[model samples]
Target: MKYGVLEAATAAAIIATSVSLLYTPPEPSWETEVVANDTYGKFVEVDSYGSNVGIAYVDSIDTGLRLAEKSYSTSITDFSAQRKGNWDTQVIDNRSETGMYPSLESKSGQPSISYQDGDLGNEKLYYANRQNGEWNRTEVDNVVGGGTSVGMYSSLNFHQSKPVIFYHSPSQGLKMAEKKQEWSKEILEDGQGWYTETSKCGNTIKVAYTGRNSEQLKIGEYDGGWSSENTSTKIKSDLDIDTDQRCDEQLAYLDTETEQITYKDQDSRTFGDAFFTRLALTSKGNTTHLVYHDEGTGLKYAKKKDGEWTTKTIKQGSETGEYNDIEIDHIGNIHTAYTSQKKVYHTVYNKGTTQKIQSKTDEVKIGLGLISALLLIFTAIRQEVIAKIIQKIGEIQR
Candidate 1:
């Protein structure tokens, strides 16, 4: 199916769901489960029909929306919906592509979705709305520089009551975009460091990235406007090392009422290699957290409970590990995904239980295969003894 047709059908379904709820409301239910994953530079959107739903990612070669559909447990039908490129193409020419990074976030309280088209030359951000079974997309910003890494290389979030974008600009440092009449303005500009990580809660934006001169990891928060830029408190710790780069970080508010930012920091332990490090706020708007790692003794968790930096390893493992991602759900559940020994793992902290999910199916299969081999060896030995008895009888007859 073409991209346009798939979106049209989805929009129709959404409209149907909305209308049905208005007329006869009942318990909330999920109509379908759709999974989107990228394979070989193509965005594959698979629907519940157990078939390939032909939805393509918008780019220069394949512009606009495409779609396909399948039935419940039935084979997917080879039908599609597509919309050809017919928008303001003169805005930017995204030809010399270095890297294309796409980030998607749904607008709060509205049926609108925003995505960033990060290309080498024409780096642009866009917002699209689904109204009455049609999609209307509008360009929000056209970032200059063919080499600048714009858009969400780290994280993207929608702040309630205000539409703001927290992203890293190669030249503009850590920047924030506020919704304006047509285009947004860059609110925070730090000359010392380049912003590498960002997350938003309400109107506050927390950023973690490498700093200038020393290249140390720094965390900052933005609120109201640029006047709040100086209010960002830097976390201090003895675990901090020079020449270390913050690869990835995630921020979440500890308490929704207090609006405190609790973030995880990944720092380079070696001169060239990096490891996972935990940090938390000591006080409201204060910098630094209790810091520790798992490789030393036990599971490590650091927190700034009152007004001092504390460090303690909470859970310890023999092997070294690094945190890949961290998310705090609506119910104060901390979900952390990490990597250990080239295997992806997840740990969820909720209701005082830490459930560890690991990828060890391959090892289990190998153990079963070894046991089967031993059984086969025992059967073959019995057959050999029977053959030897038959040979002795033939010798007596000769």
Candidate 2:
């Protein structure tokens, strides 16, 4: 009977210790603020330049290309009247039917964007770059003959410190535009492309897209020259492609008619339901992060680290994350710009906030551990096992 009592006491002590160790408080909430609003955000693309973040999107109501620049500061009081953080917004191009599929990036600390000039009769590709604190817009490509449409799904990146853009022409399939002293255009592949995403790692540049006519997913890689490889993966909507420092390419896309966000690196994994999905990678730990929108929930983020995948909800709303973009800075800070209810928002995942919260949680856990141990010792005395502990102590002394 005494042994049974001692056994019960031991089980209670183990359970108490387990509960204290397993307890985890949630992380700090995301710092989010409006960047632009009022039916102006569509096809948003975000990129990080040093400690600053830049966003380019289409203004649906005004039909223009808009840009928002915000420098990240840890203190919320850094800016006047800041909710999270305020952005300096401007209209880079207000031409009619322009800014569809704006892709933003930075090279040599200057932000630039490549987008489509969507005027039906003068359909063309446009490039805009910030020079001397001013935005200079230039016409990149316009193969306007026999009803050819160019620059619908544009993707921009830098190669060897030069700006390169991958886009699709309805009559010419897949194309690339590179500016070397002057802007030049070339055909990468032959197929009506739906979505085009480009990334450059080391000496290799890769472009991933889908065929509009066949609905097939394909990737084209360029080391010295262009080469094509086909994938059996068929996406239900647009997709994002990125490469880590190790040059491991990843693809994140809306799969099965937007029922889920599917990520493919070496293998594929699906994370619930999502609408517009965007992907970014951090070289710090080779972490692949994705920002996406659920149908009824809100904006969500998922990341894979150390072979395990974890997700967190950024914000809650039925219409949040409808159109979104994700970018990671040099220090591993995640910046996301998304549109919810037609208003564009910028959210940051502050690592310092998470670390402080974790430190407090660790202190709480240590206190709980001590308390649990004391309670178990008291239970041992009540169960008459105090004598046994005393005897063990005495034996150890001998």
Q: In the order shown, what is each candidate's alpha-carbon RMSD?
A: 21.9, 8.3
Over the stretch 1-398, how does candidate 2's per-residue lDDT look in tens digits?
A: 45665677677677768877898755545677777778564688888786677888777745688888877644422321123545788788987788987888898888899988877767888899989888899999885631357887888887778788888888888888888899878887777457788778897888888987766788888765778888877777667788877787788877745458788888888877754444443334656788887767887888888768899888889777777888877645677888877888888876644555566768877877887787678776865667788889999999
Report model 2's TM-score to 2 decimal places.
0.77
Best of the candidates, lDDT:
2
Which residues of candidate 1, in runs, are more than 4 Å off?
1-118, 125-139, 143-147, 152-160, 190-203, 206-208, 212-221, 228-323, 337-398
Give per-model TM-scores. 0.38, 0.77
RMSD of 2: 8.3
Off by over 4 Å in 2: 1-28, 61-63, 74-85, 143-147, 274-284, 352-398
- lDDT tens digits by residue: candidate 1, 183-206: 465635554333244445445655
lDDT of 1 at 302: 46
Query: Ten residues in a row with the worst lDDT in model 2?
Result: 74-83
